[model samples]
Target: MTSAASPHLTGGPETLVICGRVDADRAELTPRGELVHGCADILARALAGLPATVARVDLDMAGVHFMDTAGLQFLDVLADHGRRRSLTVTATNWNGQPRRILELAGLDTTDPLTGLAVTDPLAAAPPTAPASSAVALERAECLHVLQEEVEQLRQAIASRPVIDQARGILMATHGCTSDEAWHILRETSQLSNTKLRDVAAAVTASAEADGPPPSPELRTALHRAVARRRRGTGKAT
Candidate 1:
């Protein structure tokens, strides 16, 4: 027997509508509409509604036409939900604007949710080189790029929880939106010449009891980043 949820939106002109069904140990969620602010909470609630028997969750993202940077939080919600329950969560059928958004975010566009690249669309294209050696070299370069991307995806997946935690801390402490928090973190990382994950970890640690705050350099960088955001937007950040 299969159980399904009623189709509904989170209530906005550009909102996400979630509808899905569960069968045995697998739950399939089909989300349509724009993935924007408040979308993550809606996704979290939908995941909570699933039965304990579900060990895997798959999202069909074909209908999802648009996604902003905040959409990453929607993915984070799925990841956090899966991690807490030891479930396998995957979002597939990504294309168009959402896929482009994933690419811009340095995520795996082919399979963003799992951070897995299922296919190499570039490999199928014939090499334009006239010489066999040149073709081989071109292929090798492509292979190298693919390997780099795979490694990046692995690192991104591993760092996601800490980064999300850091973003939440920034949002709460600074009274900023998720997008603003992300920009702050990124700007801090670049300005301080530090890795983004390291910056995130520092932010997370600073919020915890008895945990050390960010170092002087990072602290200065963060302040500058927040200031820049506020000045650029002409609003609180």
Candidate 2:
């Protein structure tokens, strides 16, 4: 049954159509001065309502322009849920900012357009059908294995947005390259006795509430840092 208000509806037998945004605002700019975080909430709520008989989910993200860690978390959750139901979830309109964010989070759209199976490079192998006598056991085992892998993939994918957001924040505040920002985050997390994930989460949350921007000072510092790094590399060579 489908409701007009809801962007997602469970169709008969084997399909689901989810259309909406997962973000709070549409015009918010990224550290790089681009709009982001659009239409994530709509997507999240839709994915949260997976039906048991669904074999495929078509996600329309064309209207989404900006997405944050929360949006990424929703995707991971949906991917995991679809896996448990043996459903394939294909995302459409993932180019531009949405595509960049997904790629940074390790959820490549070109992979398989499915669930956790896409995340697991090794899960493509065909499963052997069990003997009729032990069919129940086989089903249980398959479910269990798929669940474990899904959970792991979900966790990994969830972490990506946090990390990327943190990197973005660092780039804006510290005027560092993406790589340098990541390194700072890693080093700071190590020195502060915090998990890298925790640090990333803090940065993202802080940014949402209000934080620094990619100011001119930061850009200057970043340029200097890049130049220094280049010079060092040249010297070594």
Which candidate number would show the highest lDDT if scored against the true structure? 1
Would you give me the overall lDDT of model 1?
Answer: 0.80
- lDDT for each residue of candidate 2 in 1-237, tens digit (9 for 90 to 100): 433434233222222234333232111111111122333443445555544444566655554444444455446555765566555566566656546555554455653244344445456444554554365565456445544544555687789988998798877865557997776666656555666787677667667747544345333443454455446446321
Range of the 10 consecutive residues with the lowest summed lDDT in candidate 1: 116-125
Using TM-score as the measure, the top candidate is: 1
Clashes of 2: 13
TM of each candidate vs. truth: 0.47, 0.34
Q: Distance (Å) between predicted and true CA of 228, model 2? A: 25
Worst 10 residues of 2 by lDDT: 25-34
